[model samples]
Target: MHCSVVADFFSILKKKKKNVFFCYAVLPQNIGTLHGLFLFFISLFPFTLILTTDNNYLFTKKKAKKFSFLVVWVQFFLARKKISNSTESIMDNAPAPSVYIKTSPRDSEVEKAQNINSATPFVTLPSLPVPISRGQCVVYDQEVLICGGLYTRDCYSYHVLEKKYKKICSYPKDVKLRGHSVVKRVNSNTNDTMLLSFGGYKNEKKHTLTMKYVSVWNGEKQTSNCNQWLPLMDKNEDKPIIIGGDEDDYDGMRSVIGGSNNHLLFITYRPKNIDVFNLDTFQYVNRGILPSDNWIYFHGFVSKTKSELTSTSTEANEKKSEMILFQRKTGLAIEYDEDSKSFDFRKLSVFDDMAPLSEYAHVCINDTILFFGGHGGPKLGVSKAIHKYSLKENTWVKFEHNLSTPLSDCVSVLSEDNTYVHILGGFNDHRDEMTIHVKTKATDWMDEKEKEKMQIYNREKELEKEKNRKKLQASHFFCCCLFFYLCCL
Candidate 1:
């Protein structure tokens, strides 16, 4: 019986040709241990050949059991080799996104004389399906959700790894919205990232102020055709809870500073109020006022708070992030605290030496926050510089690499693995919507490459200047000799 089974197995293996390992890999993952061992024992070439040649050959149960013990190690080795090779091949062929816009050129002499800092390193990816600005966005795992923007109902999810924008369901209803506030709901139980959106001008006329009954979207089900903006429900009730809007709630763009798991902190302009909204209670817990009501745009980072349960309260275990809200014309800034509900001058050590910039796009990678192009001047002004703040070192640096042109009113977000950054649609000085994508430099190898290229650029310029100087000297000597000869004649 064993001899006949061996002949059948060898016949199958022969039909498979040289793809023996592929057959092994295709084995069902949940195969029972005893069944798998029996099959593996039959796969041995020597025993199979013996069975095929000699029908009378005695097969001992002890030998078969001993041979099956090595099957697990053999199976593991073959599967691991195949998987590792496939992984390496995929990584090697992975796409590297590049810059798309033509950067505004700068004269080397001017750059040197001014002693100006350079921009941050960036790579351009695919543009958004539509141009947008002054919208609300939040980082959720691998994607940044652009909920809604001025005069447009289109909402998009910018995927970092894929380097593309996918228009995921538009805002519910016929009314378009702009200047809204969107924040990720903390301590969410579902695998999908839950988001709460509030405070946008509906139809560019009516205000949808407050978080009382904010519209909620789940990442899992928020598809391209999904048009539902469901209301947040009460914890105890099966019915939907109406989000209440305050009469005094200002309807405009809100800057998210940082907040605890149960709370969200934001700084609102015009009124210049810093308020904290509780996630559990779905209401405002604390509110503080800013000194100047100036419309200085704020950019900040929120440390990813822990989701694990502990003895301490969630708020006590987490540290709130500092904000970089400052005026462009006047180099003044204000830092707010969510815990104390207090405001003060921004860390003067960092802001004192910083240039006045506004409307810049910023994103966090590792321990650093990168600020991109912003309002460059008085009216309709935009900038082309990239500033980096290192949270660990407490130092700021300006890199030579920059956006293709002056950019402002754009949104930027970091990837889940801290490997890429996508700067979404914004506008230029000409008021042209820049529906472009940008990536930040993440690796030390990339930095070295940029530095090497710059050195080569400088060396080439120096050689060209030296060659021009020699030519001028020769021309001068010839002119002098010609004058002397003419006088002699």
Candidate 2:
């Protein structure tokens, strides 16, 4: 909280030279004004400061509580009534330690444009089924599948078009997993592909966690029943965890990241050891040992094009798919070699200009990736910046921020039509509670390449939906004809 407060103060201080003279003043006349100052002073105490500034932009390293405790103040000479005005007072969306943005007494057009861009509105979506964090969100078709999170045992499917959600059933008994891997099964029934959820940090009773049963969701089913989920359990010593356990996916094959068993959510080990778990046979067919790199934490993702394209989708796309993995200091690109059926790894040349990313959330629009809040530093603070990284350029290019404190452990998903990217559900760095933060924005920020590819995908999805509609209409007609023929007989 102090970290955020000090940072806010510095930003406010640097915004205008006018506020500088008043920084040291104590307004005792008004109790409210004095109180705001009191909290402002309070923020200076708990911070561990190593600040870097260039052209008035402040970068801080104080960890804890994500971004919390805003300190908003305005012109003191304003009448009390005017002081309460929305512009003079705290921003409605920003919470706590109120900080009102004060510009120079004489504002220029450029400053006004910058101000307008700073306050760009965040996307608003329907309320979540429940406030959740440390959970996983899978962009399944036109719907979002939200799995377990802190203090929640239920699952939910959020429909994008309808802008509503319904409970999708819960884990059996007391099963709860804060961090778990959710992946679409490669091969499945003709109706639709199924989704598999397994492995996690310490969720509820860590002792009860085992490879004994993997939860399965039938995407084609509409009803929410525990019976609908098939239990995938072939008990063995492997115990749903290898080299501990985590919720990350390896080539969309296994659920193991540095986060391991015993509720260990994020470990920094990427071992050379590898094992294969056959979804069909439910057995470890082969095992091979995995990267040396020193990243306190890291994140991995694919471009939007990678997810949309199939092996034969395009002739130019020779490599099947690519995953970009980056740690605090360096990045590695993992691509699958079709001929060898093995992954080829190499270092990414660029260094991320943004803050160190770990436990961050992102959605790829075209070839550009927009990264949201994550652990800011060693202190485990949260970052408010929404960073943009281009796959083509392989570099961090731009950034935005939320109106309020940033969240950690949040997840992001793209709409089926590629019109919007939804970022949802994260917790404060200092609290156990889940923050109800969900935002949706149109893909206007996406690059031209992504826009074009996504437009094609959108058309394909529309054609498929149309074909399904026509098929349904034909089936209904056939049923009616058969009934009339029987009556004539």
Write down the TM-score of every candidate: 0.56, 0.56
- CA lDDT of each prediction against the hidden true structure: 0.49, 0.48
Best by lDDT: 1
Q: Which residue ranges in model 1 land beyond 4 Å of their true spot? A: 1-120, 139-144, 159-164, 174-176, 186-188, 201-228, 235-252, 257-267, 296-324, 327-346, 349-355, 377-380, 392-394, 443-489
Per residue, candidate 2 scores C-alpha lDDT tens digits across 224-247 of: 423234445446643342323343
What is the model-wide C-alpha lDDT for candidate 2?
0.48
Cα RMSD (angstroms) for every candidate in the order listed: 24.1, 23.9
lDDT of 1 by residue, 1-489 (tens): 001121223544666633221111122212345434544543443332111111112223333335443554464445334443444332233221111122224334323423322343455567777878766676665566777766567777775544457665666574446445666653333223456666533223333322211122323543432334555666586655433244333354455535544455464544455565555665676666655435534433334212211235455435444454444433223444556755564442344323556667776544455777877557446877777765445567776666788887777765544445667778887888767766654442134543353344334443443455445434544553453334335
